[model samples]
Target: MRDIKIIWDFRGPAALKTAEHHAIHLKEYAANCAIEYTTIDIQTFNEFYTIAFIVVKEKDMLSVRDALKPHRAEVYIKKRRD
Candidate 1:
């Protein structure tokens, strides 16, 4: 099955920190709710932009998306270890 990335974007001077903190919450939520996910992480685009994201199976996308209300989503392609 494919994966889906659910992203929450943050912007401002504190974007990176906020995104990092948000990723922690995403992990907690998944643990508490028994949600299956491949990864949860943060990405910093710049000082003013960052994002927190969780990658889950495509089958789990709708429920997670409804509960999390993320800013965006896309197909997640996992990088193969070579």
Candidate 2:
């Protein structure tokens, strides 16, 4: 299975905690799922921002997205109006 990454970015005073909380939600969502996903956080630019991500099989991308949606962290491909 090909590995794919999905991330949720958090910013502000409680960014780190928020990212961790978000990771927990993702883990819970993946429980009993067919995909193998790992949750991790990256501290970007000091400690004011943290990004939590899941590394999962490419085929499980949709499932991952579902878990990420509640955080409004799902990445969307926007079509240009031009």
Candidate 3:
């Protein structure tokens, strides 16, 4: 199994409510997929993007990525190296 880092960028006003909304939605998404996920803030020129670190079994990579397609507009994936 390999660890993967999934980054989701939310574009909009950089308000507290916006950030909270992203966190809440992501939390639900992760829980539903049963994937271990953690989130952090990434600074950007216009808005703040949320970067989620998801650790999943290598064999389940495609499945998990597909399941998260709803957020593709702001999502990205990468493998973690030791």
Candidate 4:
């Protein structure tokens, strides 16, 4: 299955919380729309930034994108077919 990973990077004060909050939105959207996805929040210490990840199938990309349109940044997509 081909999947796309949507990423949002947040920095500045309370970066971690901001990223987590964004993840919450993604999770809620998926739940409401009955979509399956994997989300992760990571804190980077080098310069202090948080990363939010949303992994969903290629077919579900648009729905996820629209749902996360408010705060969009650093979108990295991954795909694999085997």
Candidate 5:
């Protein structure tokens, strides 16, 4: 029952803002489509690169991936608060 991270990458000066906005749409899509997700977030690498990602259970990956057509994906590892 592992989780999967689906990621969409953005580049250029507007990358950060674009990634953030994409995360918003990811949330809306999950809500409207009744898609289960652990979280949706944007990661800033720098002014030139950013990514929007949605984490969902492995079982839900295919459906979400097909619908979203993200740039890439990987196994999701939850970070400990500590």
Candidate 6:
């Protein structure tokens, strides 16, 4: 299996709020998709907002990425062998 980090930037000042919103949505979506092992992070720097997710496999990671694409911009995904 491989590990993957899926990330995307949020365009606004409300980074924390946006992250929290997406976290909630992600939780529900993950449960429905049967992906149990993942971590979601909300990062902010000055005027930048980003959401990051680490998962154990590319298949699972891509599933989450697809789910978040509509609400996120500049999506980036990284993968590593486990």
State which candidate has the highest TM-score. 5
| lDDT, model 4, position 36 | 80
Per-prediction TM-score: 0.94, 0.67, 0.46, 0.70, 0.95, 0.63
Ranking by lDDT: 1, 5, 4, 2, 6, 3
Question: Distance (Å) between predicted and true CA of 64, model 1?
Answer: 0.7
> Would you list the C-alpha lDDT of every candidate in the order shown?
0.95, 0.65, 0.51, 0.69, 0.94, 0.60
Model 3 misplaced regions, further than 4 Å: 15-19, 37-53, 70-82
Task: Name the best candidate (by lDDT).
Answer: 1
Tens-digit lDDT string for candidate 6 (1-82): 6566555556677766776777677667777778865465666665655564434365566566676664433323544789
Per-residue lDDT of candidate 1, residues 5-67 (tens digit): 999999999999999999999999999989999999998888999999999999999999999
Question: lDDT by residue for model 3 over 20-63, one digit each (tens)?
Answer: 56556667766776766434333344444433334445555567
Per-residue lDDT tens digits of candidate 2, residues 1-82?
5566677778888988887887777677677565575444444655787877776666778776775563334432334998
By lDDT, is 3 or 6 better?
Answer: 6
Tens-place lDDT digits, model 4, residues 17-74? 8777888877777788898875544545545687777777777778777867634534
Candidate 5 lDDT tens digits, 8-79? 999999999999899999999999999899999999888899999999999999999899899999999988
Count of backbone clashes, every candidate in sequence? 0, 0, 0, 0, 0, 0
* lDDT score, candidate 2, position 80: 96
- Pairs with backbone N, CA or C atoms under 3 Å apart (clashes), candidate 3: none
RMSD in Å for candidate 6, one decimal? 4.9
Candidate 3 or 1, higher lDDT: 1
- Cα lDDT, model 2, residue 67: 51
